[model samples]
Target: MTTTTEPTARPRTHKRVPAAPNRARKNPTRKRGPGSYAVIAAVTVFVLAFLSPFAIILVNSFKTGADYRANGSLSLPEQWNWSVIGDVWERVEFTQKLINSIQISLGVVLIAVVLALFNAYAIGIGRVRWRTAFLVFFLGVNVLPQEGLVYPIYYLFKEMGLYDGKLGYTILVGITYSAFGTYLLSSVFSSFPKELIEAASLDGAGRWTILWRIVLPMSWPTLSVMCVFFFVWSWNEFLYPLVLLISNDNQTVPLGLSVLQGQYSSDPTSMSAAALLGVIPMIVFFLIFQRSLTRGLTAGAVK
Candidate 1:
């Protein structure tokens, strides 16, 4: 009994333990919520709404004129007249017009790209004196009503002996109207890391070399976007060509298509066919460059 009492005399001391790790504290903002599904649904609806117009156009393109007029644009053709497409091809000189459009569009793309590259470099990398002033001047021209320029441009071209069936029309249009492209490309150029240019210079690269090899390669996405836009604009341009070129053969596809429309006035089928022919190439071009366009937009946005 004495031994047991002696052993019990020493009291046991308790040791404290550290608290459990706070799992929720790791990333508190990542907690799931109810509104996410609503956002997803809204985006889905918006995309579908955007797609509906193109869907209608494509559907209508396939329809026969009678079927279209009778059943409406929403309905499919009772018979897909593949021959009508051929008929249109023969009458509209589709190949020639398409080639002409391609040539004009490509010319515009090349000229726009060249001018935009230089202007963007000057504004973005060089930061030349009065850069902002120059940029503002271009912006003013871009935003100003085309009606204001029409009379002046016409008068100037006439004065310079650059009017009517001259390649000058294409060149002048490409060069003078390039300010908008410059503004757009300048934004992308501004976003590029200046360190790349500095490093290139440090390695004994000339400005031209760096621009061609380093900057151009890295700037493909934005450049591709601008190219597509310029090409589309040039290809679709009607008024400018109409005003600039007086000769029938000098006319671009857009103007030529109007002529073709008159020639095929009695044939709605032929008109529809010609319309399809005119549009298909553009659709093809879009499909080809769509990835680049999307990539460019996303890159520009994120940067």
Candidate 2:
């Protein structure tokens, strides 16, 4: 009894466990090699090269004709002439051109997106026969040069009485743009989750209902990106607008910018001003849809 009581009086000693070392703290700074620096330098140079034209346009826009001609487009303006923008604006009736551009771009985007959705739905989700052939046809349409079709399109539109007006041009551009949009969206839709489509079908959802409710909702990011691209493409269209639009009232911004140039000699400053102005709207549009574009681009990678 006395031995048992003495054994019970002894206190137990515990062994301590070592804590894990933080891998992050061991190597806080990452060492970049010469290749990294070279890549960075190369990217910087490319960016500067790409932006140089815009820089020249901006610098010359604020310069006088004499200053631009004498000191060159690369030189800084002798005086900051804010009036040049206003003068160029009035000369080109830029407000009307801007409105025309907005209308055409919006209209084309709507038509192209709708047509693309319909076409993509038929080819992609519907699992139609000859879908591969249809995709190939669309791809061929994209590759077909606008230069080759200009005459035919001009004649066709003229015959249809849709040649000169914004409505006609918008429709033409929308249809042209839809080919590429359809090709892009068809590829995206082809890879859509079959389970969702099947489930919807099992629940008595029709094609139209399934498309609007399930497909379209899930495809917003891609659709938004397509809309942005269509708007930009339509806005920057010079060839069709130049060919079809004869009246000053129906001209877009790119066509308006062309008015600033002469066959031989033109006001460099004024031309630069107009060019700078022309770029602003595109820049604004890009800025507005920048987030959507990013999402659409990364959606494939995320999946």
Candidate 3:
């Protein structure tokens, strides 16, 4: 009887135990913290801020002046019209301006690219004396704003009788643009494979022969990229061309656009459309040669 009572009392003293934690299930359905959402929101805001101005420009370009003034600059237009581009073109004499732009841009590209190639070869590969000094001088020139040079150049051009003509202006721009090309092309030339150059030298190749036969042929892509950049820069150049080109006949696209601003200052739509047209060639040029540009930029950064 005593044994049976002791066994029953032991059953009454039993306690409950907790189950083990799930170590095998690694972070199932992890909830994103507030930081991730904040990052996404910030990036979206940054993108929108940058794009808003261009979006407004494109939208406003399609609307009439009346609508734009009535609805404000950011409002959606009741009507969209493509004819504004044509009207602006006719008023601005777009054809002549386009021709002038092309001529000036081509001249700049040709002169700058060719001179840059020769000068960079001398400095970068040929190891010319005082090369670092020359590079520093060009760097100083490159950083000097066109505004600072305008007065000096204006006086110089007047003295030389080159102030208001297309050829003279083109020459001036090409020379200024060559500063950038020289630096960029020097980098490209400096990055050329030393082993190949040594091999060619061992093969009895003279400097001129190496430049023309090996360097020039191999660097066509970089040359093309530099040419395109030079062309675009010369095309969009406003101040130098504006100050130098007083004659209506010699004015380029940017000058024409400025003229339209005075003539059609009240008509914002027409002005924007014409401005858009002027930049279209640049956009197209970049799109077409983007691959080459990308390649050229990367190809000479390393041996």
Best-fitting candidate, scored by lDDT: 2
User: What residue runs in model 2 are displaced by over 4 Å at the alpha carbon?
Assistant: 1-24, 301-303
Residue 217 displacement in candidate 1 (angstroms): 2.1
List the candidates' TM-scores in order.
0.74, 0.91, 0.80
Candidate with the greatest TM-score versus the true structure:
2
RMSD of every prediction: 7.3, 3.5, 11.3
Q: Which residue pairs clash within candidate 1?
A: none
lDDT of 3 by residue, 104-200 (tens): 9999998888888889999889889998898998788899998999999999999999989998998998888888888877877887877878999
Quick one: ranking by lDDT, best first?
2, 3, 1
Name the 10 consecutive residues with the lowest summed lDDT in model 2. 1-10
| lDDT of candidate 1 over 1-303, digit per residue (tens) | 455544446677787787887767454476556798788899999999997866666666566777877897677678876777776666656677677677777887888789988999888777889988988988887888766777888988889888884466778668755888888777777777888889989999998998899888888888888888888888888777888876755666676657655543554545555666677788899999899899888874422
Model 2, 130-220: lDDT tens digits are 9999999999999999899999999999799887899999988899899999999998888999999899999999988999999998999
| Number of clashing pairs per prediction, in order | 0, 0, 0
How many pairs of residues collide in model 1? Answer: 0
Model 1 vs. true fold: TM? 0.74
| Candidates in descending TM-score order | 2, 3, 1
* Residue pairs that clash (backbone atoms under 3 angstroms), model 2: none
Return the TM-score for candidate 3, rounded to 2 decimals.
Answer: 0.80
